[model samples]
Target: MSDHAPESGPRRRLRLRTLLLALPLAGLLLSLLLVLPLRWLAPVTSAFMIAVRLDDEAGRWPEYRWVPYEAISAQLALAVLAGEDQRFAEHHGFDTVEIERALSAADQGSKLRGASTISQQVAKNLFLWSGRSYVRKALEAWFTLLIEACWSKRRILEMHLNLAQYGPRTFGAEAAAQRFFGKPAWDLDAGEAARLAAVLPNPRLYRVEAPNATVRTRERHIRTQMRNLGGTGFLDRLSE
Candidate 1:
């Protein structure tokens, strides 16, 4: 300090500018580090699963079984796509049409419906916490973009099938199929798959074991939608 001259204002500003420029680059690199390897590596668990385990009152961890995409029933995949995000193969990450519809519904004095695509759900379930905050949303968007860029549509759907909550204290197709239908995920028929897909909006409330009126309605609707989606043939788009 005694030998060196005082830092000039321009030098301080340049340093600040350099740091500002570096921040996003650093973030991108970190994000890539987190996402790239997941292409081949199946995640042992997700952030939502961790939170579920930590918040359990009886020390009972949620059920989760990671079945490879091929091991999971193609019917289940089509069921979820029909029930949750029909445009899964078309959109890169976000479903702009659904977003616009939600925004328009809110403007018309209706409740804001979720427009999250399977890819976005994968990003949120795997990496982020559950929240409705703008900060969380911005992060979700950032991660969604990274995932779409890093992984294919099929990988994104595979992650969703393995990570989404299907019933209370149950996560993933294999776990849900075993818990509810007493069968493996690959053996789940179209009806069972649709029933599981039906409760995805709120698994805690919608009981797969005891389908209430609403759950039954959603199950029927999902089955019909699955048929309209051309059964499992609709999944051919994922391969493209």
Candidate 2:
């Protein structure tokens, strides 16, 4: 008869250490690899836009244009930052204060609002799919850290402005500006930019050209936030 014995302390500890080290090492490699490509690669499209197109052929294909960061009106960028992420310039990748508030709110049975920062949104839009899966969120966090580490904050903001969905078939500031205001993105004024930012929360439900009462309210809120964030000064430190 053969007898089997459970592994003892030293061997078990060694195995544990290997596993602990392996996870972080693997994460480091993934981040480093992604960082290098992102430094020079301006992605023409994103996973979210592709996903939306695949499921719905009811509308025209989304309009998308890649404009340099400078080509976009600073107001539009500021509106989006104000509307979606006020702490965008301050936070590295995650916003723990908002995260904690969301958690506390959830625990209290309050309405759940997403606390995804702009960087996290960019990570999700560029590299991952939409939805509220913990698995997807974990991957998003990994990619967010990589993006924050590898790219300038301006690059992150610019990429986000060009990729986030503005309507059912509208992608990017340029497309949304043209579609809604009949002007290029660079020409977007404060009200136009605020309206666009208003639709960002739920583009399908809000129309920029014909905003509903709710959307109008949101637009007002975004405009107020934009002023609070100090207009164009928000991007001061976001350069290379």
Candidate 3:
């Protein structure tokens, strides 16, 4: 035997332990550094800026304007909750029920639907790229946990509203409100909020200014959902 040492024994165990410890420590540090700042400072840009720029020439100059959670109307907030994640306030970060539904659909060979909640959407839109890769999804979950740990539910919703895409090159509730209704987000009435929220599934295909039949049906469903969810009281309950 030539003096070659097999890579095993106590030394290997030591290295393995070090790596395991290092990973958690690094994750903790990353969470603190990134998530803490978001409590005060709004993100100037997001991963969407990267994804969009690759597609359209005009996407290079994306539209995004952040507004405080208070500035956006209650109706808009309720509409989004009703439209996107009805259990947003109830769950920590993930919705197991929705996940189960998605898994069941996959098992049945039925059309699959995204089960991402508002928090996950915020995390992805703010930090990660849009993709179907397992690595991307794992990172999205990590970011989502960081966000849930660092920010309030209200803040999460507010950020989602601001960062979420509304139309081609249009972002934020304020911008969407302006582009679609010619008014600020704060002034969006219930009907307008529902209409805007309805287009969230495919903003590019839906029109807020003149909602077609499909959008109208979705809008009606959202309104009914809002009522079924007991209105904005659900948000208050979530905070408690």
Candidate 3 lDDT, tens digit per residue, 21-57? 9999998897679778987888887888667877876
> Candidate 1 — what's its lDDT?
0.91
- The C-alpha stretches of model 1 lying farther than 4 A from their native spots are 58-60
Pairs that collide, model 2: none
lDDT-based ranking: 1, 3, 2
Rate residue 184 of model 2 by lDDT: 93
**Which stretches of model 2 miss by more than 4 angstroms?**
1-31, 58-61
The estimated TM-scores of all candidates read: 0.95, 0.85, 0.87
* Model 3 ranges with Cα > 4 A deviation: 1-20
Q: Which candidate gets the maximum TM-score versus the true structure?
A: 1
Give the C-alpha miss distance for residue 22 in model 2, angstroms: 7.6
Candidate number that wins on TM-score, 1 or 2: 1
Candidate 2 per-residue C-alpha lDDT over 34-107 given as tens digits, one digit per residue, 9 for 90 to 100: 66687777786788888877878674456899898899999998998888888877899999899999999999
The residue-by-residue lDDT of candidate 1 on 179-198, one tens digit each, is 89899999999998999999
